[model samples]
Target: MKSRFTPLLAGLVLAVSSLTVQADEVQVAVAANFTAPMQKIAAEFEKDTGHKALLVFGATGKLYAQIKNGAPFQVFLAADDKTPAKLETEGDTVSGSRFTYAIGTLVLWSAKPGFVDDQGEVLKKGAFKHLAIANPKTAPYGAAAVATLTQLGLLDAIQPKLVTGENISQAYQFVVTENAELGFIALSQVMADGQMTGGSAWVVPSNLHDPIRQDAAILAKGRNQPAARALVEYLKGDKAAAIIKSYGYAL
Candidate 1:
């Protein structure tokens, strides 16, 4: 009986050892707009692959700056394709590791229900005193907001009422806190399971602005990290794609 138990114990120990050796951690820098979906994806990724994703969220430009300054992030999920392409050109990312993970949708959101119309005529109506947007210089969603307003011929008219946040998260906060009447933000921020989680929102038409092709890549710092490589591949999987779509992002 003792000998039989000894072999079982040895097998269990070896299995546990194998699991420990297989698990790895990756530090990921993610765009602010992708916060909700990325969280879900990270959880699924860990469950499926036994690889942990340690995520940091920020504006794309700021994250790019941090990456350039040697931040420990091994993976980057940028708000736009351009930033990752620039990094690739600059040799900051692993060659051939970059891919577009999602296409983002911008929304005009108000914490108050029925405050924004489905057609997004609120900008032209100009009844609100303050409208929030992320700093266009550092956030692609903000840039898209600007583009939308421009396309609608409301930029000059709405400029005076603009309240800017450092990033999309902050812009969303401004609306949530009632500091601004409404804001331009990522659809993912206000959506879950193909419905608005709360408040009123106008899904900005895709043709109003440049397509927000969000991309991801393994950074040079993660070139040798298995977890980083795994994460890049995981984002392309059906589970991750479903989560992204559930957040109102296009795959």
Candidate 2:
């Protein structure tokens, strides 16, 4: 009887192991500024870790609202540290699970070649008909853009020309589509291999605004999830860091 039971137990253990090895999908809410890098990280994560990350991109504030209202996302990659910290405080996230994954940089970019000056003198010149920026109320990058303008004492003057987008990705589109002459956007949106891929841009100085310390956290719904934890760890790994750095984000 003992010998027969031992074989049955071994078979059960093997079946459970096989189930664990099979990839599990984790739903992730990602900030728009991290779009390109997140896409790359998700592909690599699935390939190397046998876990699938189903990513949804949007403004951090909007994503936070969704989470508060019980969105089924297991992981959140925010564009700023504040939103994750807030979620942790609100008991919406797994405690002690939040960490800064990347430091984002902002840029003023335009579709027209040589339209934006490196020194950002174009803002003062104000020749363009429209200047696009993300909605500061919802997008951290947009808040940073506003902060930069305030620091330079140009907020009031630039307000008349302002065209706001719901998120940084849309703000970038406004400029790239030439709907707005120029726009404040994430450097990663228009950069490749640490250089501007097209048109001209002014890489905004870090001192101009608060550091965009992007953070990632596991949500309450994901507290018991192995696949969610795996994604959080994968984001801190060397491969993910390299992909993020290549997109102009600092690890």
Candidate 3:
């Protein structure tokens, strides 16, 4: 029995080797705030090219740390330019593959109607019991939320009511689940077909905070791969950019 089993081991290896030689999946590390859009983009990208996007969503900072520690992601679509720029400076990314894909918008949103009015001084009015924001320490969007509140002179007034999510996606979840009466989140979190749905929002005037510019870059892990380079180039094309803009992002 041992001799018979040993003879088939080489055949088994040949079968597995054939499968490995055929299919290659492109792994991408994406920001949590990009969940919906990336899912859509991945589908479109898969259809356009034979390659598939093995999408992983997490905070941009965490993804950076993971990549530094040898996570095998080929591309990174960060929530901000900082991480990508740092990767480039650290020689962890392809020099020319960096590009801004979209300008994100921060909004104060609520699942319930009239729960948020970004322009109506809702925070200063003190109408809500709780306001959720992402943990500014980890999320760029959350940091921007803090910056916006500070710029409006409402940071002090809103401090006590703040509830922090581990990331922007969770912050949106807090508002959606009614755990938070209102919260600051990425505008894309609530947008569909280039418009907002379900609740009223003020669209937080851009002047109140720094722009939310999302950038993508091909990591060193992908510098030598044609499929990864193709994906990065496709993201910059008119078709992909159009889809990005349709999801309430400004390209």
Candidate 4:
């Protein structure tokens, strides 16, 4: 009986060893607004690293809460500099691994044809009854929306006509669903397949708001994970920067 069991035990050990060798998949927490580009980048990352990326996409604030609760995210790709800075202050990150991957843009987007215009002067004209924005308290895109309005001197004038989404991605959904005639959303949300959507958009002027410097950082969970660090460095490379630019983000 002992002799017969030896072969079975040896086979089980080999199977476990094989599985362990392929378990280098990195768990990444990405902002929801970055869903599209991150998908493309991950494909490239896998091709180069032979390590798969397990991406979790959502609002930066919500992801922050999840991380605080010990979610197994090995790294964070946040839409704002604030959250990553906070995490580092709290000692939740691997020291010296944080860096800005992209500068995001906010746009006044609409699904209805001819609704938006080149310079976005249509907002002052009040062509649409409602304007959409992400919740300014949590989503960085939301803050950009507010800044754009304030910079255009229309925030108070259009206060009553504003609708809000919990996150920038949801704000885009509001416009798509016609819940709001127009909403402020991340540029990537409307740029699909390397093209802009049907309606016109005025990419918000960068000077109107604080720069949306999207910071990526390795979590404490990935302290010794070279793949996580390599992934961050990979993003600064030519291929990844191209992916980032194709999505309407500035690297």
Candidate 5:
């Protein structure tokens, strides 16, 4: 009886040990524009892989600065592909670990219904007292907004009316709170399930600005972290792609 019980006990111990080894947590620095989708993806990732993602959100540039200063983040999801590539070139990321996770869309949005037209003629109309935009120096979407304005030859005209936010989230907040009549922001922020979540918006044309190719990478700090690698792989899977698309981003 003792011999038979010994083998069974050992098997149970081994199984528990395997479970413990498989479960892990990773710290991730994510772009503010990706908040909603990343939250959903993180939840799904934990349920499917038993790996937890601890997310910290901010503007891509600020996150990059933090990472440079040794923030201990294992994975980085940036608002533009350029930053991750720069990290790779700077030897701050794992080689061949960077990938484009989502293609973001910029939108001019207003919290009030019918306030913005589909053609985005409002910028030329210049009817609003305050037009909110993220800081172009730190946020990719804000740079895109500036580019679009430049292409439309309205940057000079709209310069004085501009209200700048530190990041895209804060820019959206300005519009939502009516501090600005409308703001340039990510399409994901105002979209859900293939429909506008609220108010009105003008989806900026791709030709108006450079493509917003958002990318992800495993940082040097996460080089040997299993959870970090798992999260990156998970982001490439079908489930994560669907979640990303549902938030108004492209593959």
Candidate 6:
């Protein structure tokens, strides 16, 4: 019996050893607008590759600053293309390591049903007491919102009622919690399965602002990391693209 069990034990030890050798923990900094889809992608990546993505979420600008200052993040998924290109120019990211991952969609949303119309005429009326927006300086989605307001000539009218959040996620939260009557937020935040879950929203037209061409980059710290390289590849795969599309992001 001992001899028969010895081979089984040896096989088990080799299997465990192989798993330990292949498993890698990749540190990632992600933009808040991409949170939900990324969470799904991370789970799928870990399951399929046996590599873990330890994620930290924030405004893209803040995350970029952190990466610049030697934060331990091995990868960055920015909400805009310019920041990653800037990092590459500054030698903070691997050369030829950046690529467009997804194009984001912005929405004018309200927690209450029927409060926001399809054409976004509520802004013209200025009936709401507070309007929540992410800080434009730190959030690409917020910058788009500002651009839309500027195009409509509503920026000056809405300035006083604005309630700014540090990031898009927090701006969405403010509307959900009734801290603000409505908000300009990423469509992904309030969407699931390609439909809006609960609330009234106007899917802002693409012409209203610059295209939010989100980009991903391998940081200098991850220049030679196998896991970091794998994660970037996985994000561009069909599975991840489908997941991102389900949340209303354009591929």
The top-ranked prediction according to lDDT is 5
In candidate 1, position 50 carries an lDDT of: 97
Model 6 scores a TM of: 0.97
> How should the candidates be ordered by TM-score, best one leading?
1, 6, 5, 2, 3, 4
Q: Where is the poorest 10-residue window by lDDT in model 2?
A: 190-199
Per-residue lDDT tens digits for candidate 1, residues 1-251, read 78979989999999999999999999999999999999999999999999999999999999999999989999999999999999999999999999999999999999999999999888888999999999999999999999999998899999999999999999999999999999999999999998889999899989999999999999999999999999999999899998999999988
Candidate 4, residue 148: how far the Cα is off, in Å: 1.3
TM-score of each: 0.97, 0.92, 0.89, 0.88, 0.96, 0.97
In model 6, the runs with Cα more than 4 Å from the true position are: 4-8
Candidate closer to the true structure by lDDT (higher is better), 1 or 5: 5
Per-residue lDDT tens digits for candidate 4, residues 132-242, read 898888888898889989998999999999998888878888899998988889999888656896776788889999999999999999888867877888888999998
Instruction: List clashing residue pairs in candidate 4.
Output: none
Clashes (backbone N, CA, C under 3 Å), per candidate, total 0, 0, 0, 0, 0, 0
Clash pairs for candidate 1: none
lDDT of 3 by residue, 1-251 (tens): 88889869989999888766644578899988888888888888778776688999988888999999999999999999988999999999999899998889888888888766657478778988889998887788998999999988889988999999988988998999999888999888898788787886767888887888899999999987767887888788887877788778888
lDDT of 6 by residue, 178-231 (tens): 899999999999999988899899999999999999999999999988899999
**How many Å off is the CA of 150 in candidate 3?**
0.3
Candidate 2 clashing pairs?
none
RMSD of each: 1.0, 3.8, 5.9, 4.1, 1.4, 1.1
Higher lDDT: candidate 1 or 2? 1
Each model's lDDT: 0.95, 0.94, 0.86, 0.88, 0.96, 0.95
State the lDDT of candidate 2 residue by residue for 182-250, as single tens digits: 999999998776777899989999999999999999999999899999999999999998989988998
